[model samples]
Target: MQPIVHPVVGYVCYAVYARWADGTPPASSPAAVAVVAATLPDLLDQPLYHAGITPVGRTIGHSLLFAVPLVALVWLVARRRGQSRLAVAFAIGYGSHIAADVPWHVLAGDYHELGFLLWPVTPMPAYSGVKTLGTVGGLEVTTLWLEAVIFVGGVALWWADGRPGLDLLGRRFDL
Candidate 1:
């Protein structure tokens, strides 16, 4: 899967979370948290990996080591503070990122890579620091099936996000 696909997955998960849990659209503060949490792993992982701080993009940041405890902590705090919905919304997006990434490598028979999902408790292999984001630029040519899924999910997200969250520009970035 590509990087763009991750966030699209996040958005789709946001919609799913709303429909299944909240009955409200994934919007307002929760939507804001979801969007950021979705992309956070890559945002923190890449530059660190690129700079040789870690051997792989899947580090503590991408691991259950980080996510489980963080989400638990957030859930606990949110419940105490009466913000459980926000915590659940963020967890949906954050967890969906890892869920989506796991299959992308697993289907290719990279079993050892699975440890990255639970890291520290499981060992990690070196990830050659190479940029993969460029792969997304050739969307139509390289990843026809994946791109199609992204397109459909994007359309769904547009509808589910209440269809002009795009007015963010005119609304002066309400998100």
Candidate 2:
């Protein structure tokens, strides 16, 4: 999935999960945090691909090996802070991003790409050259259309939310 789509779905999942778990209408602050978490995998992996630090576009960053522990740490802190709902919301965002990518991975014929899901236990397919978004492996038109649909769906959902403003990068404002 594309960067924008990844975070959009993450925000929606965070909102729904928050409502389910906490019986709240998606607390603005936590939902804001979830959006960044949703994009963390690509955020961490891509620079490494460009810098020649890793061969694969997906690395430990995309693996449960990395996310689980980080989430566990966040979970612990959240429990202590009495904000378990927020922590779980972040997990929903992170996990949903990975789930959204699965279809594209399959369409690209990179079924073996699950090696990245295993991280150190299995070697990631490290290809040379910086990876771009939309289609994985090659120009798979189906995957491209799937991405388009997902992104458009996200836009529609955002509009439905009355365009709840996100002040994610500055002032730390959630609403």
Candidate 3:
């Protein structure tokens, strides 16, 4: 899961939250900040890759520990800025990233060496295997399949969200 995937997952998670939870903000709520905050940890990893402190896609950005605290920090900052609503949105989106990515990786058994998520305490290994849906001749067809699934899910989310009274918070937002 890269940064791009986080928002979609986060939105879907938010949708589910909105459907089940009374306090969930709708699409019109100030969710952009929270959504971005949820993805901020990964964005921070971009600089680390340039400095060689960590590999481009192998760092805390993909870890639960990092994502939770970062989102909390965002929430705190947003509170200070009088944008707590946005902070919550970011938290949902960011948390959604973890919820979606972690389990799948766990199930696939594809974690990498440097990708020790639990770190000093747990040092849990991540799944590093590529999940291919199928193979066409010599080429793997998993990528296309994954993309299609994501696209369909995204479309469904958009539709579900567009329904009346579907937005989590009633107010508008900016990310």
For model 1, which pairs clash?
none
* CA-lDDT, candidates in order: 0.71, 0.73, 0.59
Say which prediction, candidate 1 or candidate 3, comes out ahead on lDDT: 1
TM-scores for every candidate against the unseen true structure: 0.76, 0.79, 0.64
Q: Tens digit of lDDT per residue, candidate 3, span 4-93?
A: 666666666666665566554355554444355546656766577678876444357756677667778878998999976567677787
Error of 3 at 98 (Å): 2.3
Candidate 1 vs. truth: CA RMSD? 5.1
How does candidate 3 fare on TM-score? 0.64
Q: Say which prediction, candidate 1 or candidate 2, comes out ahead on TM-score.
A: 2
**Model 3, residue 63: C-alpha shift (Å):** 3.4
lDDT of 2 by residue, 20-87 (tens): 77675566667766777889889998899889988877887788899889888988998899987678
Candidate 1 per-residue lDDT over residues 102-151, each given as its tens digit: 75445455667677788778877864222223244565333436556786
Q: 174, model 2: CA deviation in Å?
A: 13
Model 1 alpha-carbon drift over 4 Å, by segment = 126-144, 164-175
TM-score, cand. 2 vs. native: 0.79
Cα error, candidate 2, residue 170 (Å): 6.9
